[model samples]
Target: MNLKIQKISILLFLFSGLSVFSQIKEEQLILDKKREPEVKKIEKKKTSVESIKNYPPEEKSQNPVEYSITNVPALSDFQTSTLQADDISPNLKTDYYSNYVRFGMGNYGKILGDANVSYTLENKLEVGADAHINANHGLQNIYAWDSRQTSLKAGAFLNGYGEKGKYNVTADFGQENYNYYGIYALNPASDVDINQKVNAFRVKGSYDHFSNEYLNNITFKSSFLSDRFGAKENKGALDFNFSKHDLELPLNDVKMNADLGLGLETQSTDFEILNTNSSSYFLGNLSPKVTFIKDKSYLTIGSGFTYLSTNESNLSLDRKANKTYWFPKAELQLAKSDELKFYAGVDGGLSLNSYASMLEKNLYIVSDQRVTPTETKYNVYLGIRGDVDELIKYDVSIGHSKVNDILFYQTNNLFDTSIAAIRNAYDFANTFSAIYDNGTKNEVNASLQYFPRENFNVSGSFHYINYKMENFDNIYNVPTFSAELGAEYTLLNKKLLLGFKGFMASTMVTNLYDVTNTGLSTNYTTTEQLNTKFGGYVDFNLSAEYKIHKNFSIFAIGNNLIGGNYSTLQGYQVLGAQILGGLKVSF
Candidate 1:
């Protein structure tokens, strides 16, 4: 009985402990449920603050430190730095044409034609061909005088460039026909027909090494000329030039340049006459020069050594000569600014003379004539040139020159008078011969230009010369004073162009021969000299052009508008007022 009672008490105690543990767990679960919503609310508030800090501002301020609308670039409007096609201005660009043609006819039976075409390759090589024609039947007032002329020329050229230099080659052929009509106007009683024809062929080539340190340039040329009078001439020349620029000099702020050149020329002429005379000439020249340049000034010191040899079969003469000439060049800018500048220089050179060239200058020259080259010993000049303002500019210069073997035109009186036809023709033909003289000349020249507007420009020049001949009493056929004035105007957006030109010259002296019977015989005659003076006159011309399209245009030109009859040569009277119209096309 005592053991049962003890077991019951132990059971009661165990039950009480289990009930207390259950109460504690239930209270803890209720507290956890109530705090869950508070933790979620704190997480939502933290997310809101982070979003506000990440967003950008809406505007930027003028002050760099502050944000405002002015400082921010608009995202909707964007531009690139490169130029767009739409931004190019058409008026500042010019269109190029690879082919061109021009044709014209005028009063006095004048006709003209010209054409040119060119092609360029991918390698920068270019090739081109061109042709031209000009002919005139006769003047209206001159009746049978028939001042007719025709000239035709055709040429082709090839040009290319390389990494170091450029090169070009050209070939050409030409023909010219002219008639001597001045005799009829000078002597009405004489009747004669004089026709002259010239044919020429030429080839030329040049290579320039602009970047080469040693070899600079080279040139070669060959030409052949023939006339109807059984005269032929062939000429060839070769030239080379070497230069060094920016050479080291002893002085500071000063640069030096040196150049060396060599040239050789050969010419041969044949005249088909009774004697079959032939002449040959060989010439060589070596030139060396050094130049020094500083601020606003330069000085060039040079010397030319020449060797000349000539052989004439008919005269049985073989002549050889050598000469050396020293020429110094200098220029100084008297003013510090470009608006006003004064400069001076001394220069001289040798001039070549040939039958073909002489014939072109004076067609009346005898077919078989003697000729010699001219030498310009020295020329000294001083000049001032500058712009007075944006609208005006002026240049004036004074110079003195000493020359040897200067050519002059004079009439010949050495023809036979036994035959009536020969005498009459020779006496009245008024043909000219070339003569040489040594002399000194003084000259003054002045030029002025005005550009008052963008589309208009006017220019005028005046020249005065004084000649002192050592062997002759006076210099023949040379004008002492001359002047020219020209003006150009553009209108209608450059579609129409107008031009005016005027020229004036002073009087000149010419010689005339008077025939007299010396009572010796009918075949014999005496000639008396009569020095005549020709008064100079002024000439005016006008020209206009209108463009109908970019590729086509029409032009009209009027010559000698003032109608002042004048003679530029001894017995040649110039044409009166004449008009010409033409069309120009390009593609």
Candidate 2:
């Protein structure tokens, strides 16, 4: 496949995979107790961790067995609940610290920061604000296109408690800035600003009923986003549920409960191009469920319905943006004892493919593309979780799902002479495009946590997934298998702590288009083939913190201790042997 020499060099992009998925290797800090995501998503109608208010949060990487260091969606909506962070200093006093702050700096121009402050206005009223920063200038002596990046997020909230219910409202702002540094950086392109910036704002309100007839809780959120380019998105969502858990039933060893939910989603986007018109979509859901409870066991059976409507917002192929879907929901749990249990279930739903959620998966996705919803047709799963001994616990689950309009990521093909001039800056083979397909996904998630003693702990987890799609050759950029392990220990009367963690993933693949002549010069054809193969890598980090006074502590962290060459994202080189240290204060 040759002849279109100037553009066919896209084949030259057949570079070896850059590195293993990498995140700063360090033990989870800021209250080592592992916690689930506080902000909820409308992915499904499953039970999730209860949201907490004004508490010292564990490190957040971004959740499933949610890691405190990186937030990558491995199983889409299949979340693991066993990624426990060890509490190394069980003897340390923790209740007095009401406000917290921390800051640190490291090589590669890396900066780390987290702060949360709250004040009690009266016996039952409170307010707080929080901020987080994670940024790095560049991997020195690496690429040439100014590979600098930063993520900044901040938010504030007010809360009120009454005899009937609890109320809270919050406002948040965020910004992400990065350069489209890629192999294209080697070639000179002076007309565009390689730097990209996206800004976001959000408002949220929730009511938790202390006592009500059928209403349990309600939540609503609104968001707006804009990029340096002409791309813009506005979104709003409402989710609420009604439930009753203790109604007597005629069946033996059984009780009945009514579980119902209602949700609404609205979004609009401006793509900034004339031919590609702006679009909007709205999705609403209704779920009805019944659950039965027995001794240490329970079962839930239910179904859901989703209605979708769109305006000029259709998927690129196959799926239509406007449609209605019916799905199943059921779960079974059998427990032999408090130490062991078995579970299985089948479920499905529609996931809102908003601009913000897509960017959460791949930060480099093009900003000016049509967005739609992903339909998870069905998911059947089975698993067991139990305490192996007094010091150990384990959970393992396997699931298979039929999905439609599944979202995946791939490199945006570089422009060729057949097309008009580049319309955006992300066109240099540096940016990614969101791809959707109908397919099946098989996944396995296993996690183990050890608590032999109060001052030391160990945890490990493994995830494997395989994808077969109807419209694509291979799943791009996603690892086939990945695993993480970490441990921490405390000594010196629980004043000093040390910990280490590491992760690894299988090789990844990406395909691009190549032009070839079809016998005659006047006719031509294009074929898709593997153009890049990213190599797998293993990396780890070490951390230590020492408390000097009751209200103050100093800590140090080191990443990539082995100096491995890896990029959490393919083509992006991570800094080698990074070290960051700083102070923590509470008042």
Candidate 3:
């Protein structure tokens, strides 16, 4: 039989139906992630089985079986990756000097000057100093009283690039002087001069770890403020943060992290809320957060527990200012691509307020203004941001807020028969008062930036807000709608730059009190209230700069070209048009 079938090859065709299964265990991926942040991702592909196709039966098979079948096996999942960036280098400009000095002068006896100096030692340490001054003489013919102001600011800083962290320390000082001249029908010849002179000092320090984020940073700040009106303040704050990354959860396979922050603040002031009472405050907060990141999304949840203790001389109008607050800090981010993102969050906290801080906002406020902390119960917001072709970027957001004890600048209600009869500097509607109110606020915000070319760019921002207060009819000095637009064009090899800026705001609300003399001159009283509205104004500005040398440039700025008499507060008018020319020297 072997000799006969040697040449003829008999192929045995056996047909059978069978099914096979295999259990495949997925391999968990471990990524060594460092905090060079920001992410966008998508999920991986799943394993799949290919369906078997039908085949024609063998017509001349001698050993036929029951049936014919095919088997399909799944393919194992795999991923592909590109080269990773593991090294970095310094990208410093060789022909650039960051230190400069500028000086300018304009009409109305205006003067402006600023100087900055910096030095780097051995590529490890840096020291810098800066100073700024702006002053203007009195504008007498335009206003009934003198309108004059002088401001000076100076600062110095030290920085060190340590092996494991970075260190920064800074000290700053400021001096400001201005007159309360926002009065109506006042005689300039009368020697009724009330001045507001303030002096401030601050010291700040920070330390940030480079690689070890567990002890991420520590920051501390202290400030001292005093004024010629016999008010003084001393305040300090300290905070630190720690973080743990790539935490392995109990039973979940996701990227996670934990972060914790602790802060402390204390303030004691002789700033009189009334004429005789002082204020003191202390606050401490502990915050903790956990973050979980999956394929193309991230979620963070946290809370801030704050203990606040305050004593405003226990005024008769209020019992005490002591409370504990809990604020939610939660957010989620979903990314469709590297350039597009959607985010939503709910967060709130406590805002510490002081007389010196109030002066920073409204320089014409009363010296004995009432100051207290603000409590934000919650802020819920949603936003979307994206970039197109690396040339344009846009973001829009909408939010709602619940707030307590918010501050507003309103005109003081005081009466005087003559300038000499004014008892306080803020009398005669010359200065503002620190008014507090509770309310719910809803707002919308949008911004856009376009960088179509290296030499030309444009930017715009818009905001809309509405407040429903509980006790007050209106929120003083707050605009409901605002918008700002700016554009810059650089030609002549980036040496000749032209800039344009414009800002617009909607109507603002304020109130005036009607006064009626009583039976005697001693008891001055009135209860009737009056609501006033000031129409909004629009303003536009332009600037141009030309470089004569690499280290020198001359610039001119034209402000309020629209000349619409823009005023933020009542009875105060800005200059119609102004032009200031300045020179800069870099070395």
Q: Write the per-residue lDDT of candidate 1 for residues 49-140, one digit (tens) a residue.
A: 22111222221111223211111110100100000000000010113554667677776676767676667677868787877776666543
Report lDDT per candidate: 0.62, 0.65, 0.65
Residue-level lDDT of model 2, residues 1-587, one tens digit each, is 23465224223311111123234332211111112232311111121222344221221101112211111111101111001112121122344655667677767777767676777665567787877776777654766456677767788888776655667898989887877765432253443557778899999999876542487789999999988877788999999988876678888878877879999989888766423436688889999999899987999999999998877743353323567889999999999785688999999998878777777666676766657678889999999887655566778899999998888777765544233344355655567777788999999999887776676667788999999999777888787888887666666666766665666777778765454545555433555557367746666665677788987888777666556655545455555666777787766
On lDDT, the stronger of 1 and 3 is: 3
lDDT of 3 by residue, 140-179 (tens): 6677556777767788988776655667898989887777
State the displacement of the C-alpha of residue 406, model 2, in Å, after optimal TM-score superposition. 1.5
**Candidate 3: segments with Cα more than 4 A from true spot:** 1-94, 185-190, 248-253, 272-274, 314-321, 415-424, 513-529
Model 3 TM: 0.79
Worst 10 residues of 3 by lDDT: 12-21
Candidate 2, after superposition: displacement of residue 261 in Å?
A: 0.5
Q: Decide which is better by lDDT, 1 or 2.
A: 2
TM-score of each: 0.77, 0.80, 0.79
Model 2: lDDT of residue 526: 51
Give the best candidate by TM-score: 2
